[model samples]
Target: MSTLTAVNPLTTLERRALQSISTSDGNMLIVAADQRNSMKAVIKDAPNGSDAITREELIEVKADLVRHLANHGPAILLDPEVAVPYVVDEGVIARDTALVVGLDASGAETVDGLKYTRFVPGVTPRTVRDLGGGVAKMLYYTRPDRQGTDSRIFAEMRDLIAECNAEGVLLIVELLTYQLEGESDEDYAAAFAGLVADGAALAVRAGAKILKLQYPGSAEASAAVTEAAQGVPWAVLSAGVDHETFIGQVATAVANGASGAMAGRSLWKDSLSYDATLREELLTGRALPRLRELADAVDGRRG
Candidate 1:
């Protein structure tokens, strides 16, 4: 077991989720399709550029992706609103695949010039557990140089941690960065590495057991982020970067101590333009292969 697994120790629920998600080598290949508005945007802007889709089409597309992706032994992150319930009801998710549910309703736009994520008003840890989710996920906006925790964000995370603990489920906290108003792109760029490292450290300090963090820019930087984590198991998020770029990022992260990856867009974005059959083919052909390659990369580092 890893130091975090030993020190914190997994509850039965947490262990079940972890076991379902992790390969025998204890590395993971997590397919994150839990996007909300971002997913809609992909569909809207698909190749033809003007295709109209019904609610059913959106739900089906997500559901199919979940089903197909799960077959490759990857844990899937799905939105509770449409994807999770549908797949669970239809028995589409494989029994051995871990199911993680998104607990936030998020958009691509910033709120008051700051980017952040909040719990969807009605969703709770218990509700997600009841919906067959083994893990509940939430994303938080953070910056590298920030002093103290944003009181509201801290309070929200604390409550969420407590709830998930009580409900016997795992929590995966994702930390992200957005440029604040008046900050130059150059300034944010300079701080990007610090943001990835320090932001992850902050989340770990906030009691996050499983962290989803950005790649911290390079292998050397990733090592710094890992050290700051102090042995907490963390995975890198793809952040909508292109596939080849993300593949390199994942390899670098794992080599530098990241446990695995929790990525979305890079895996399936290209397939959005195709029909259902072609989409599934693309998922199996393109996405699954990439996930397996990443999984192998993670396991290689483990060895």
Candidate 2:
């Protein structure tokens, strides 16, 4: 199947960013840890965790993830609030490691099982570049059904895409779906494919260079999403699923034409139960092996 040509030719910087994030073989294995308010919530609920954490602690935790994990080769995604600043200033990011800065805000509220996301002001592609970010990433929720439409979000995405293109920065757009009111589990299951495909199509049309998306149930459904992506590089997000399930999804997504994965929680969320030292140990011991498995999966597909 033929893929669509990029709306704008990839700039040298964009190409460099893509290469830095991917393996030497050009297979992506980006590890997304850029959760803001959500991270706080996770930390709060973690076993032996705190209800409230200092900004310093947050930075330490995120920095630890980069220190231990990002060095392993997968590109790292970080939030602008504390993680990005800490990583860049402290030189936690290695020269070869790809650095992605999160541009979205932290106020995603659930309305009847559906999520409504709003963009936070202040972080732009230019700011991301200035902060030494190789790629600027934004995560937003969308649905195939019109009832989930947010014109403001779409408009923001368009502007961000234009800005990234003009500024020579790579943009990674993450498309997630939510359950709407009166929608049963069966209804959601039925609409999953169209939602994933439609969301990818919309992001590509808005000029996303790379898309971070949910798995569309099966390889066949994922193929339709790949078809809709029109040649733009797309990766599967973990969505907090267990490591095994996510690994399978990554393999399936790549077999069906996805480039690779931009996953978060599934990779390291399990390691959140211990103190700093033990946390790092569990993350390094447990998470690294999982990533290695994923990398192998991607490599197999590329082969």
Candidate 3:
């Protein structure tokens, strides 16, 4: 991580957008329900897989998630496809809770086992603002250890950053690292922290203002990410880990310097079900507590 300074001060609109998605104390607790294909896969793999689930069913799931979880956090991440216009128009999300729309496509294309990101057609920072969203999120795959692995993606990211700045919307650049082809599991695990730290630095250099990063594997690595961010606020993503594991990660991360968390599956994976009544029970009984716990973890360490 370098000690370089930010390129410029945030625009007034950008500053307000950032405030809209954070607590009064300035910590961020974002509930991410923006998954598309992954959520569909979860629904399809259920025992009942009797019929192909329709888009309405997926929207219902997303609505249920937003209905149950959005108010508990400062912000919620929803995709433009099923969740955004529907959730916003229907008022499923609370008025006070900020909305973050994901701009990336559901799943990435793979070439030689390396994943590449694709954006949803016609979605941009301006599109997010037009949707009444305060934040726009873009997820990209990277391998920081290998130079030029994602140069094209990096270029796109730079362009998006410029667009977001011009549009006066806050952009949260999310970095996801994958195990490369022919890499051993052990080696991948060993290199996880470095990859995350380097990836964050790379994003920051690309002019990312806010970051949603994978848990960097240790307290030391977490601190490195904060250092790499150079005072730009960053929140650790849950990455589908269980609630208990994610709680520990949030604790270590915020204690070191993370602003908060942006989590999805970890907070509500088991709560999802086709049975509406049962889903409510699990979301209320299991997921809500996890959200509160994670929020407490972040708030407790607030500076």
Against the true structure, candidate 2 has what lDDT?
0.78
Q: Write the number of the candidate with greater TM-score, choosing between 1 and 3.
A: 3
- Cα RMSDs, all models: 2.6, 3.0, 3.0
Q: Report the lDDT tens digits of candidate 1 across residue range 14-47.
A: 8667767777788766888887667766764445
lDDT for each residue of candidate 2 in 229-268, tens digit (9 for 90 to 100): 8888888889889989988888888888888888788888
Clashing pairs in model 1? none
Residues 164-270, candidate 3: write the lDDT tens digits: 88887889999999899899999999999888888888888788888899999889999998887777778989999998899899989988888888999999878
Candidate 3 pairs with clashing backbones? none
Off by over 4 Å in 2: 1-8, 41-48, 109-116, 147-150, 301-303
- Leading candidate by lDDT: 3
Candidate number with greatest TM-score? 3
CA error at residue 236 for candidate 2, angstroms: 0.3
Model 1's number of clashes is 0
Off by over 4 Å in 1: 1-9, 44-51, 108-113, 301-303
lDDT of each: 0.76, 0.78, 0.83
Error of 1 at 159 (Å): 1.8
